[model samples]
Target: MDWLLKATTPAEKILVMFVAILLFAGVMAFILYVSEKLPRWIPAVGFLLPAVIMLAFGLLWPGLRTIFDSFRDAAGRKSVGVDNYVTVLTNPDFQIILLNTLAWVVAVPLLSTVFGLLYAVLVDRTRFEKLAKTLIFLPMAISMVGASIIWKFVYQYKPATANQTGFANQILVWLGLPPQQFLLNPPWNTGFLIVIMIWIQTGFAMTILSASIKAIPDEITEAAQIDGAGSLSTFFNITVPSIRPALIVVITTIAMATLKIFDIVRTATGGQFQTSVIANEFYSQKFSQGNNGIAATLAVILFVLVIPIVIYNVRQMRISEGER
Candidate 1:
């Protein structure tokens, strides 16, 4: 057991992994062999059993526990009914979080999609088009945490007297203006953080939308042009309507990602300066503050928020498929 806990050598760890894999293979083989000898339904049961058990243990049971914990006290020793939910809904800090999250969900997807669509259109088929699209889409390759760090330096503020290390403040100094604290200011700080999300997610929006735009038949554009439709008119009248489904999917996906934006907020702001959103607040309550009840309540709120978007996305997908 001690050796199992700590394999000191690389060879020992490799040997342990090999043995585990061999055991797993043997168990799987034995199950299949036994199931073949049993009734036809037995193999079907065997095939489904692992997945069912995994769903139960991993998703269903934890979800139920979280929901159950939402109604319980912080220590889980007593029931508190709706107190947790009420507190989260009415508390000023949590209210601010909800508002910030709402702003993020509204602003990021819309702005990102708009920028992405514009960029996609700009470089549609011009010379160096691939290079241009690649540059715009490169941000999506960076992790959220990495993007935040990159933008954090970009937004870094310094005292006017000090030599400015931050790009933003350096530009201010060069322009004979005062350096401003970007992340330290509340409300506006949240907006600055939201910009980071938009920058990263814009590439995702562009990639999807560019594909959708390319799929739009060139004949339609040519006919529109023949009808004296300007480029702007063609985009609004034909290209947009043709790609509406992809636009909806992009917006919904980004909204979901924006709602669950934790890494950037946590890594950049540490949920301070009134920049905390629901996901970050959930982490704060659960791990930092040890307010388990409030954490569970926040989790439930996030879950509720996501359900409608997911349902709408699925419905839209089905509608598109039906239309096709």
Candidate 2:
């Protein structure tokens, strides 16, 4: 056990992992072997016991510990009660972070879903539908860090007179305008970061919403056409109503993702230029500033924020399922 805990070399770490896997497998094998002779109810408990123990140790313990640490001081040695939470809510800097997070949550999902729905509608049965979707969905296949790095270069700034390397700045130079620092300016800089998220998420939104649109009954659409409904009227009156549940799912799902955004801000700006969200701020507080209490508080706040969105999403899903 000590050897496993203190594994230093790659070989030793691999050996330790292998040993742990073998031990887990052997234990499960024993449990299965013994369960054959056990009562029917006992077998179910036997199967679930390992999973419950793992979840308790891995998730429940860490979650409770984080909540506990939220009340401790910066050094995590003294009780500070709600001081960290107070500072987070009251401090001007944290206020900006909260606002930025709010902007991200609002902007990303709304814009992404709108763009996705529009694109999905435009290419629903087009000759180049596959190619068009592939172009947009290609970004979704890239890792968030990769997408951020790509956009970071695209937004890269240079002196007005100097040769511009960034595609956006180059275009600006072509228009005889001064090169703007997209990542350096506050407020608007946050919008630029939000674009990266929207770019990635739009693909996800389009795929889900497109499937929902296709699932709409042809008879309903044909009946609308048989009446006085034009293309625009049919879309608004028929398509939109039919896909409302999917729209809710997409918006809430993207909102949750936006709330937890860290990689884009971290990679593009290092959360500098007043662009930090709660996820990045918590990471900076915990590791960079060594303020565990505030970090834990932010973590708790993030967890709390996600719960309502998740609940709403689940409820919407259940309603959709019941309707089906």
Candidate 3:
């Protein structure tokens, strides 16, 4: 505290701190009044008002500003029309980022949902069901940064002839293969990161899918058995088709999460070795490089990318609702 007072320029520090304290106090009071004292409707309004105001201030305004800026030059001083958009689509590195985005959107969700559904089905009625589910679901409770740190060690690397100590590399060396840099290679490293996402998301998918699996009428499974359908056939024909809607929900949700996978890439590689994706690129362009227009364009592209998956999720949810 003394360091802050001493280091800070008096004029800037006092004024800035004064404003910060005022804002903090105002926000705290607003929260308490809404959360504790406000009438139900007023509280609902109070809770939502800040979010709406925040959306207006933080998201909506900036989105509109970005769209405007995308039309302007680097200085944000003159209109460049569609040139920035055109350049983004054509730029090679951005193109890789776009492709990387596509790969994430495609791979993580499908694998996670599939593995989740399979595991959910396998353990749904088993004796050790709770334990199995808990083990797999543990990663979902971990923060992304924490998960990234854990996997970073698992994918740890050392140069050739050095002792292979990374979890994966050690396994390889046990089999007499050379130590390898799992997170440093191009294209494949992207897949390695996708594995981390899948590892984390599979539990979510499994929990949702396990419920849907249980919700399958016991009569249906018994009838399938009486009809001479073996376990595998019943799972394929009845369980899968019956749970298709839930699967769709899992896939879509995971897909949306995958598109914004900044933490994994950022923490593991810092977007080096051609592993950059749209989310990391946006941060670099906007904050690191101070290219707000390009950042906005990237955000807009991501928004466009997410809308369809969201729509599909909504439609699947509706279908699930109708089925009920």
Candidate 4:
């Protein structure tokens, strides 16, 4: 009370009084609104309207603008009428990026999901199953940047005749082979990045598949055993089929994520050594190179790639729900 009375200036007292009055009014207003004043949709629209407008602004408008920009020139000053698209599709570097992206889209999702599914099954019944799953799932908690840094150290290069520091090179040296730079190669270097995505994504797939596996009825396994089906046959015939829906979800989710992979490439190689994919290239062109049209084209391409996959996943989920 002494501190409150210590303000010499009348403006300070007024300012403090204004804030206290504002707070009191806000509390009263909230209570009144809860009692009767505000409309039912006020709160609903208050939150959801922003999100909806944001979707339209952030995602929808940008996507449409990108599609429009794809027709323009690099400078974005004049309409080039598909010139940017043609150049992107035809250029050898761009073609390599497209191909690398395709390889990532295909290989990472397939291999990771497969490995996850297999591991989920392998560890399902064991006493250490939870611990094993946790160990495998651990990588997923690390951000792509953190994982990239971790793997970067593991793949770091060193000159020959020097003590090899990179894990890959150190292992090679241990085996009496020459040290190798894992991030500097052309085609194989792409796989090194892909491996990181796989390591991160596998836990997600495994957790999903593990749940689906557990959801498989105990009676079904017993029935398979009664039918004299071998363990392999039972697994192949029962386990795989029962979890097909979850497998689809895992595969398509990973596939979509694989398309958007920029961090791994950016952090590991800075999109160098012919390793730039569409996402990284999008950033490189628009921001770094100031080629807005080509960047927009790349963005549009990514949008086109993602939309259909998402639609398919939603449809598959609905179908699975219907079946259940």
Candidate with maximal TM-score: 2
**Cα TM-score per model:** 0.92, 0.93, 0.86, 0.87
Off by over 4 Å in 1: 6-41
Candidate closer to the true structure by lDDT (higher is better), 2 or 4: 2
Expressed as tens digits, the lDDT of each residue in 204-308 for candidate 2 is: 999999999999999999999999899999999999999999999999999998999999999999999999999999999999999999999999999999999
Model 1 lDDT tens row, 1-324: 665668889988988888889988997898788888887676888877878999999999999999999999888779999999999889887799999999999999999999999988887889998888888889888888899999999988777888899898898889999998999998899999999998988889999999999999889999999999998999999999999999999999999999999999999999999999999999999898898988998999999999999999999999999999
| Residue ranges of candidate 4 with Cα displaced over 4 Å | 1-47
Per-model C-alpha lDDT, please?
0.92, 0.95, 0.87, 0.90
- Give a tens-digit lDDT track for model 4, residues 176-282: 88888788889999999999999999999999999999999999999999999998999899999999999999999999999999999999899999999999999
In the order shown, what is each candidate's alpha-carbon RMSD? 2.2, 2.1, 4.6, 6.7
Give me the candidate number with maximum lDDT: 2
Stronger candidate by lDDT (2 vs 3):
2
Per-residue alpha-carbon lDDT of candidate 3 for residues 27-100, written as tens digits (9 for 90 to 100): 97978775787555767776677779988999889878877887877668888788878988999988999999
Off by over 4 Å in 3: 1-51
Locate the minimum summed-lDDT window of 10 residues in model 1. Answer: 1-10
Model 1 RMSD in Å is 2.2
